[model samples]
Target: MVNVGAKMDERMEINILDYRLKVMSIAKPAIERFTHALIDVLFFKSYLSGGCANNQHGFVSVTETDADYSVIVEEEAYKAFEGKSQDVKVNEQTWLPLVASTGPAMVVQNAAGISKIANSVVIPLADRGISVYPLSTYKTDYVLIQEADFDKVCEVLAQNFRITREGHLQSSEIVVEPTRVQKALPSGAGNSRALTHTFDCSDTNTYCMTSMDSKSLEPHGLAIIKALLYSGHQSEVQTSYFFNLSIIEQDISLILNVTLLNKFPAHLFFDNSEYWRLITIGDMPEGVGFRQAGIVAQISEPIASADISEYYISSFYYGHAFVPFDQFDEVRRLLIKKQNSQKAAAAAKLSNGL
Candidate 1:
């Protein structure tokens, strides 16, 4: 628990939804006051277990006064935070001496000019080339600074501006190395054709859980891609979520329309019984095959969006009627008019100015 009061300028705003982090002077007495202050605020009775003990950092737990409070004294944050070294603020003139650490970085244009000051040295996490923003973005939570210039930069930060503890923050970390395997628009995603499933979910090959390392699952994958590529496809997918699982008509695994269990049929990758089979408007499985029409496909977001540091995300080459999920219908209608518009919108910026 902590015991300190804070005052901020009316214009400054920092909103951390669930976790609360308030910073006070990182000194000895100030630390004590801050700890008690936290205690006083957190004194309410928690319906369930509450209290802190030693943690990964070997810090002592907070001392609770309430007899009913969870005996496991809430671990005191100040324990570790106390007597710890603080990061001196950094500036642009500073050289990032070390290989930049990978993580989410907050680019806050607290006032206006700080970004400019930081830009001479600090760079947004994803940008590789020369583009820069005054209200530019940041690559890591911490600023990039030369260890030698650290003190000089901090002086400028503390004196000239206060970093807003809030803003549009983007993270460049992802669990999966999202990969996209290109395939013919009218065809399925990339995968070794050798592996095959019991039921070919493809337009040509019917197989379930095929050993084939297929990216798009033909006919089945097409349905999903159809919904994903186009916007209005949400209903098709939303409705499909219900059929995620239903009583099976065939001992032979069959996919079922999550919504219209009676209509569309294909083997589901996930068990609907456990109820985890909802289709996302964004993702489509690879290795599935479909009727070829020489059309192209594209991704909705950037390749970097996958948190991938490398990999050039190219525009889908599929020549089909490509329409964003939002303009699916308009694009679909355009297709009806015999226009070779699989997708009118560029998934990402493509080689062509289209």
Candidate 2:
């Protein structure tokens, strides 16, 4: 067990602990097939019909929206389209179809969502003078690159993001998957409506957030964990509360409150030290204080295991170190500073009427 002592000297920016992680990519054959490309972002009054789904077979990728649909299709797919028949008729309204030239496309499947891998892949391409037109899907991130530039794009992504042909993290480690339950809030935190929802991790399981095993987590479970880790404190009422409350309920409780509270909402009294530990320390305090130390240990003690650490780092937008080991206390303090600085900036922005 590590004791994170009170106030450490302020430090400068900390880089993400280089995990030497390997990512997966698929771009070669995609580049070989298509030099000319057409990307279509469709707008409809409602969800596209089954016909649209069937018609998009050879597309680079297709994403559906409540009001519209978007797709990146190979030239062959567009070429096969009988232009007039492509129009989707919805409620007696017709949406005309138009195709425009775009770059060759490839997809990156990451369990951690966009923020986790965006900087890893995107910035490097920007530095290498590669322009990327990205489209996001529920399960993957797609980018359109020119066939001419595919080689450079592939090289950059492969080198920096460790993209492999598999297009996903291929690892054999077993991990306990997290299960999510959406339930109505006992009391609305902010703008959430009376009958509106909050997400709770129903499982009392814990897993390593930073180790190679992280790659083996179920995609959705990894996504939810990443959501908790990568979450930043927003200034808005709804979004901010959602982030805070989620961390308290999911990452802190689901991962920590194993024996204490086996249920969704605990019955601990406010006066109890355990209760204060959850709200004040375990929740990631806004300011630095000695009283807030040992938070990582408190949450991690019950589930401590050799395969997984009591500590894990969040390699999200500006990484936050959550390790409970003394060796990483410096990194943890840096995270605290970063969070405080962000909150301070938000407060200043609000006060300045921005």
Best-fitting candidate, measured by TM-score?
Answer: 2
> What digit string (tens of lDDT, one per residue) describes model 2 on residues 138-171?
2233443444554454444432222222212442
TM-score of each: 0.16, 0.24
TM-score of candidate 1 against the unseen true structure: 0.16
- Residue-level lDDT tens digits of model 1 in 86-178: 421111221221111111132222311122222212222111111111111111111223334333332322211222222225322111111
Q: Candidate 2 at 177: error in angstroms? A: 40
The lDDT of model 2 is 0.25
lDDT of each: 0.21, 0.25
Question: Model 1, residue 50: displacement in angstroms?
Answer: 7.0
Q: What lDDT is reached at residue 82 by model 2?
A: 26
> Backbone clash tally for model 2?
4
